[model samples]
Target chain A: MITIALPKGALLSDSIELFKRLGLDFTAFLDSKNRQLQITDPTNTAKGLLVRATDVPVYVEYGQAQLGIVGYDLLLEKTPDVAHLADLNFGGCRMSVAVPKTSPYQTPTELPPNGKVASKFVNCAKTYFQQLDLPVEIIPLYGSVELGPITGMSEAIVDLVSTGRTLKENGLVEVDTLFQSTARLIAHPLSYRLNLDNLNDLGEQIKNSVSKS
Target chain B: MITIALPKGALLSDSIELFKRLGLDFTAFLDSKNRQLQITDPTNTAKGLLVRATDVPVYVEYGQAQLGIVGYDLLLEKTPDVAHLADLNFGGCRMSVAVPKTSPYQTPTELPPNGKVASKFVNCAKTYFQQLDLPVEIIPLYGSVELGPITGMSEAIVDLVSTGRTLKENGLVEVDTLFQSTARLIAHPLSYRLNLDNLNDLGEQIKNSVSKS
Candidate 1:
């Protein structure tokens, strides 16, 4: 049976809906009381493994899941060895460089050369700064990137800004946008090539579903 | 006023209680409705920054906070340069190497050489295997590591076993333990030395409270 790794957060409901259109019912994962990480569709056609968004690529890369749905931002940061199948286009957000609204700096270039920047996406932050020929220290923070500026630990933060509410409420403003992000469909390279468990047909169907949606 | 960094999860309440013993009330952070990440104690004597467990050390190291409470496992993994003040002793757990109950492996050495061991504590895993002279690939997973072996992503997982309930529910069994972990009090090195804002005195008071408890 083809197993699909589904991301657990913002993209979850839509991912389940997409699969539901394909006649696979894995929505049991959406139940608040459901603690099971791995569940099989009622039709016994495919299985779903609910995992963290960042881990979707890892499972697909290891061939544990023939296909997975993840964020485009994660694809860029992790660069996992998986086939880029399609862009599902939901869960839209942008990777942005933000600074305290009260700060005089208005853009990434205006920031001090050696200033500290905090982000969960350290790799993306490093690449963005490097491409600008800017030298800044990237402090990796696992949570509360918005607090970076408030606490004075960092001059700026590179984070995903979906509604600008989080930034606005935290007294921060977007200094520069790195890139837009949305949900992406990925498949294991070998699994895709071999058409394991009729994965090609399912992939094509999902792509059609995405195009229509 | 001295600023203290408190971790957000499991250790939060205990940490708040610890500070209350120091004559500071940061219980507002315990309210479910409170979205504030940074809060000043009722008396304005000190401020608290609620951050992820791993980020606690970063805040203290950068002196954004003169003191912080975090897990010892994080201290071992990140090796942040901060003064290890005292062990608060709450939130006890241990890092252990666990494998599927059905697996033949009985210990870390019994696992295949060059096999994958998934964990969030990659450095600690690396160091443990290196000391044991076992070569294993440490796959850094950010969440739900208990699913590692179940998904066939790794031969075993090195994770913090709190109640062993998670491991049991996942059909995993602990094979070898790395070390015990508990909440630890940490302070900025320079802040502690110079008694910045009487941080030395506060540290002593906390130590006394911990000892009495």
Candidate 2:
């Protein structure tokens, strides 16, 4: 049997739908009343573990879940050891550098040297700034990255922007996008190489579903 | 006017009540209809910034907030350079090492060497194991730590246990406690030293309130 780790937030539904295409159903997680974190599909051919998006890759990397669905942004940040199986192409968003609308800085590079940039994605923020040869301090704020600028603790913030509503509501303007993100299917390396539980065939089927969509 | 950073979760109401003793009311944060993250107390003498518990020290350490209320657990984990003022004594909990109830390992040291211990408090976990001269891998999981044992990803989990309800419900038992945690009053070092906005007086009043209770 193959175990798949599904992230619990924004990408959950689409991830479930994609898995449903393979005739494995783990929709029980979508029910708000359900408190179970791990569920086995009715067919019993697969099991699903509902976890935080950041943790999906950890489970796959550790071989706790032979397969996992996670965001490309997490892949970039964590850089966990997992096989990149397919780009599921759903849950699209972009990682962007944003600053208070009133700030004079118009782009990421324009922010002053040694300025603080807050984000939950600290690694991504650090890498982006390093690529630009900008020496900005990345303040790791796990929640409310928008508050970084609002509280004047940071000159800018690096965060994922989906609909841009959050940025707009927070009075932040995207200065530069680091990368566009989409849901990705990742597999345990050894599992993929050995074709454990017909993993290769299932991956191909999911890839086909994504192309059709 | 002084800015006070208040944590948004379990410690919020108690923190607000403590501040009420100082005649600065931030109760607006408790109203279900309130969507504001930052609000001026009706007295206008101070402002409150509602933020994640982990970010409280970040705000205080950066001097974005002259003072903040946060859990000692976070203080220990983040080890941010903020002046530790008073132990509010409310919002009490404990950081414990928990494992599956059915597992044979009864104590932290009994667990096999190199066993994976999952926790959001990675630093605390590492410190505890290191002091014991036990080699263990700490897997950082930001959410749903109970799922660590359930998913068989880790041999144990280090987490904050309040009523022990979550651990009991998840079929886990606490084998060892690292430390007892309570909400603490903290301030930016410079702010505390310079007595900015009568910070020393406010800290004294808060300490008095805590002792009186």
- Model 1 chain A worst lDDT window (10 residues): A101-110
Candidate 1 residue-wise lDDT, A1-213, digit = tens: 999999989999999999999899998998999989999999999999999999899999989999999999999999999999999989999999999988978888999998999999999999999999999999999998988888889999999989999899899999899999999999999989999899999999999998998
**TM-score, prediction 1:** 0.97
TM-score (C-alpha) between model 2 and the true structure: 0.99
Q: What share of the true interface contacts does candidate 2 keep?
A: 0.83
The runs of at least 3 residues in candidate 2 whose Cα sits more than 4 Å from the true structure, single-residue gaps closed, are none
Could you give candidate 2's per-residue lDDT for residues A1-213 as a string of tens digits?
A: 999999989999999998888799998999999999899999889999999999899999999999999999999999999999888889999999999999999888789997999999999999999999999999999899999999899999999999999999989999899999999999999999999999898889989989998
Docking quality tier of model 2: high
Q: Candidate 2, B71: how far from true, in Å? A: 0.6
DockQ of 2: 0.85
- Per-prediction fnat: 0.83, 0.83
Q: What's the lDDT for residue A106 in model 2?
A: 86
